[model samples]
Target: MRILQQMNAFCVMTLIAFSISASVQAESPAPVQAAKKALAVGQTAKDFQLLSVGGELSGEVKLSDVNADGKVVVVVLRGFPGKQCPACSAQVGDFVKNASKFAAKNAKVLLVYPGPKSQLDQRADEFLQGTKLPAPLTFLLDPGYTFTNAYGLRWDAPRETAYPTTLVLDESGKIQFVKISETHRGRSSAAEVLEAL
Candidate 1:
């Protein structure tokens, strides 16, 4: 009888321990993701291929292909982070207006729009509704921030996508100028980029 009682006690303790373990697991916080390094000037920018969102072309655009023609201006926009960013719209508009100037300098502008995989294409299309990107400028979609994270520009925060960034890559793919803005403002102007080229 005593042995049976001890066995019962042991079973109860095991059940309690299991219950506590499960509860602890259920209450545990998620693991934090490691931070990524930011891309800098003087470094050769990694080549990437992203689908063109709104442009004359309708397929994948390779960085190397664009750079082969001339210098490349890579603009990273804060994609639809819960809502349309007015600053992004303004920056894009400015670039569009300066399309001719960029062309004159033999520089191709690549605007990267990053967001969640779901409805990313639709959101990007919406962004380009009234704006017409000329031949000198190309709009690219970054589904799930594949290229953004790869370039260390992901702004991983609440209602945030990628940090507004501008990079000037020489014909040889070496980064000659780079500006990364953590806030919504502080964007590089087209004139500044034009001078960089």
Candidate 2:
């Protein structure tokens, strides 16, 4: 009878231990995803397709198409956060003013406007109002942050859109220069980007 009682207690303890182990396993959180690396110079530029809600190119714009014919590609702009950014406006204006210079170098400039999914196209159009993008300078819309996330530039903060970035790509689609602004200030000027090209 004593042996039987000992065996029962041992079985009960074993079951409790197993239960605790299972509970711990269930409560443990899943492993976190690794952080995505930011795009940099010397790396091959990742190809992305985005709609041109407004500008010279009012259609789908692909990186491959931009790099076709050995044209240098320049990406310059900030994604719209809560509203249109004055800094972005100034930066784009600078690029537009220098559109002729870009063309001279056989380069194409793409101004990326990123925002949430809600009325993204409408917002992009509103932003483009009163600003004329000449030939070789186009505006791109990043709806729902698809391109932003793919490039690891999603700001993901309140009242913050994507990180202001400028990338210069060579004819072969390799990144020649990359500037990712930590703050709204320090945007790449057209001359600086042209120098990279």
- Candidate 2: TM-score? 0.78
Summarize candidate 1's per-residue lDDT along 69-127 as a digit string, tens digits.
88999999999999899999999999988899998998889999999999998888788
Against the unseen true structure, what C-alpha lDDT does each candidate score? 0.86, 0.77
TM-scores for every candidate against the unseen true structure? 0.80, 0.78
- The lowest-lDDT stretch of 10 consecutive residues in candidate 1 is 28-37
The residue-level lDDT of candidate 1 at 182 comes to 59
Quote the lDDT for 123 in model 1. Answer: 89
